[model samples]
Target: MRAPCERSERHRSVARRRWISRASWACLMAACLGGAAPPFVSSVSFAQQPGARQAPPPAVVVEKIEVQQVSNPAQFTGRVEAIEAVDIRARVTGFLHSVDFKDGQAVKAGDTLFEIEPDQLNALVASARAQVARADATRISAERSLARNRDLLARRTVSQATVDEVQAAFDVASADVQVAQAALDTAELNLSYAHITAPISGSIGRATFTTGNLVGPDSGSLARIVSLDTVRVAFAVTEGLLVTIRQQQASGGGLDPNTLKLSLRLANGTDYGTPGRIEFIENEIDPQTGTVAARAVFPNPRHILLPGQFVTLYVQEKDAPSLPVVPQTAVLQDREGRFVYLLGKDNIVSQQRIHTGARVGNGWAVTKGLDGGEQVVVEGIQRLAQGMTVQPSQGQPVGGGT
Candidate 1:
């Protein structure tokens, strides 16, 4: 009975130990419920399914803004002309006469250009002179007869009627002499008109009337002569341009007549060596073309710039300080206005509005906005936006606008 009792005691003790062990296990599990995920599972799971890394925005090349001094030149187109030009014509009527000047020859004022046969003219002059001699002899005879009759009447040897008749004869002879003198003058004038002379000193054009071609007062133009030593160029300018010109002139910006420099480029691109000055400005504007005619005078010693030749003109305005310039690519235009992309201190791009002037070598002149040393975005401008970041690269110089 003692042994059985001891066995029952041992079983109870084991049962108690089992119950404590189960209670401790439950407490540990409850504590673990308040804790984070296990280290092994958390770390391993994250390593197997990590999220993708985002790519950085593409870097865009940019440029630095700068100020530069440049020349301001205005270009225009013009035409060449002759200083003076006139059509040659005969002043007297006659049979086909001799042309004294060769085609395209240079002639001086009063130079004989053509001549009519003088035989008929010379005969008229001789006949007029003979008439004058005969009239003078008749007048002398009438005067002697009138004196004899007067003496006879005074001596009562002749009647009063005879004396009156002698006086009338003398008067008629005097009238005849006066008419002969007038005829002689007319004949001399006709002789002079037979010779056609140049009215001006200039280059003569191709002769329209040949040596045997009839030339006279009614024969019309024989040829033309154009004076080219000093030539004039006529150009048309718009009303707006005229206003600008007037303002420039009023501002004391006009070139002196002696200092006015002008150059020409022909349609074929040949340069005219001679220089010129502005001569005249037309008062009226052409209603159809909406422009006024302006004239320029050029030194044409070589006569290379012929009249009526089309050409391009260049006029130099007042010299000014160099202007700020930028590449054309940097400039952008929209409904708002013209602007450029510039890199900021944060290495980001920002749009800046600007005023532009005439084109410089390969770029445009910045009239306003933007100081020196700012990075300007030239390339990749299309990809840039306001406040966008960019990578900048030094670019080629913006030379004169092409």
Candidate 2:
């Protein structure tokens, strides 16, 4: 044998040459057809290949612009007020013998609220009656003397001067009797004032003066009474809103105080089930707040509404015109103003600039840049690009409950 090792080496050399020739042939064939693809093909090129799977368009939730005839209510922080409020005060100077009503009690007109010590008043009345009796006796004696003097003068037993003097005495006694009667009347009237009574029908506040406390007319206020059957709320509105109201009223539009729908939301975020009507609007705008004051009246049968309670007041114009509304989620903001992504035909998304106004429920009242029946993208607006293709689905109703 020539050598086993030499024979094995020759076979390896033959295989390497055969493999090189085959690689060159393949490269030449790829160059003749087109440029050779890289060893690692990019995803972009793979997608461009015929029969390759295509990625679906981005999905978005869209809603049709609703032309709602609902009122675009404006809300403001309001303070509750009593339709009629009164400060209770003592009318007579006296020591309080008893407080008839408890704190925060409901009282009616003519209800006795407090009792004053009446011993001194009773003594004054007795003294006045005694004075009246003494004056009456003096008048009777003077009248008898005047009559006797007149008869004597007629019978020539008395002079005209003596009769005239007796007449003057009778006149003085009569005047004294009248003055005493007036004093007695005054005493009785004061006695009535000792029993303090409520002047209105409403809920009463806590008494400032308890029993044994001296109270008088000069004492500021003993307690307060607020009407519970009906209450009022006062709030401020911007000058622009006030002007619009005035214009509507002047033109006899439907925005008059009588036509407004007033509603209240308590501090605890509960609605005051009963509706209210506008009571009055202030005469002028406040210079400091740049707003005008307005008031509304609501029925408070349960006495839930109280004076000075902070609450939210919503005012809406009845029968307001229809407006295009978009869900709050669909709106986006930039330096120019507010805007929303609108879905046009061919499933294309377009950036639509809009002017927004007051909030209507869970959406914004579209003041401009949109009409009814336009499709607006609510969800998936974050990643959406202008003119991008998207797959749309019906969106959930705005303001709907879960």
Candidate 3:
């Protein structure tokens, strides 16, 4: 029952609102799609920029490889030994009268060390001398009697038997004289033994027997003396090392064990001022140890090296011929082996495997795998990779340079 014109106007208004809502939805979808599409496109463009133009490689410090003479030293641990060690002992039976030297005093050869009771020995010597005189007088008297008997026999004043008897008596007296002379010499020798003297010139240890103490051949060492002006160092070298040394000598490498120079480091970690030379090598290898015994002589003018002290011995070899060398910092080890980074043309880093020898100063002696005149990376190695570009700068030369 409503008006027809009002109903028609309401329907038209509903259609217009629906059309505006559809149009607004389409515009919102288009805006969201446009914003999302730009970021995807921009990401692709940004990645492509790096591909077109690469960044410069990381910077590193490098040194040119050079060959130089290097020294190889073999080291060993050894013990210091005295050139001469003597023990003082009494050679005869006597009561020690006095000690002539202080404890631990240095003494020269023939220095009096102790004096035993000489009273009894002196009396024996005197008694032997008196007996010798008595024997001589008796022999003279017997000889005179024999001569008188012989003259009497020629003149027929005495019987031939009496002459024979006198001659026999003279012979007996001569034999007695010889016995007395032997006894005197024995007594004199015994007296000499009563005074103990140092047999060598060296520092002596404490005396085991004091004044008034009984010391004789039965007693042990009275004291000990060790010569320190020249000392010896003894060390054992393995059979393998001994073989190597022999091989070097046979090859005419100019390594003579007798003339090899040596140096020592004391237990206190100080270098001995004087150098030494190899003196003796045992003729036979020790069966128990399978090593050869070697000794070196060192002049210990100041007596700094004492017996039983431990020290380190260094044997320097002749300078090896010049060889390729590189900074130790440039040497790297991995599962493969020892390798170093070499900067080649186009500033590209490549791994170079190397055979390293003895350390020469702060660098390594490269025996193989690297020729001379190659640039080796010394710094910033951790940032390096195979075939990676690098910015190399000149650094200190390795192995003292060319």
Per-structure clash totals for the candidates: 14, 0, 0
Q: Which consecutive 10 residues in model 2 have the weakest lDDT in total?
A: 35-44
Report how far residue 216 has shifted in candidate 3, in Å: 1.5
Candidate 1 lDDT tens digits, 284-304: 888898889999888888788
lDDT of 3 by residue, 1-402 (tens): 578988999999999999999999999998878799798888889989989788888999999998787667788999999999998888888889989998879999999999999999999999999989999999999999999999999999999999999999999999999999999999999999998899999999998888888888879999999999999999998899889878887888747665455889988889999999888888899999999999999999899999999999988754456778889899999998899999999999999999998787789888899878999999999999999999999999964522
lDDT per residue for candidate 2 within 283-319, as digits (tens), equals 9889998999988888989889888899998877766
Model 1, residue 172: C-alpha shift (Å): 8.7
Candidate 3 ranges beyond 4 A from true positions: 1-45, 51-53, 63-69, 153-165, 243-254, 318-324, 332-339, 343-354, 360-363, 368-375, 382-389, 393-402
The order by descending TM-score is: 3, 2, 1
Q: After superposition, which runs of candidate 2 have C-alpha atoms over 4 Å from their true positions?
A: 1-58, 64-67, 148-163, 212-222, 237-240, 247-254, 284-291, 322-324, 328-358, 362-390, 400-402
TM-score: which candidate is best? 3
lDDT of each: 0.80, 0.87, 0.89
Best by lDDT: 3
TM-score of each: 0.62, 0.72, 0.77
Error of 2 at 307 (Å): 1.7
Give the Å error, residue 319, model 2: 2.3
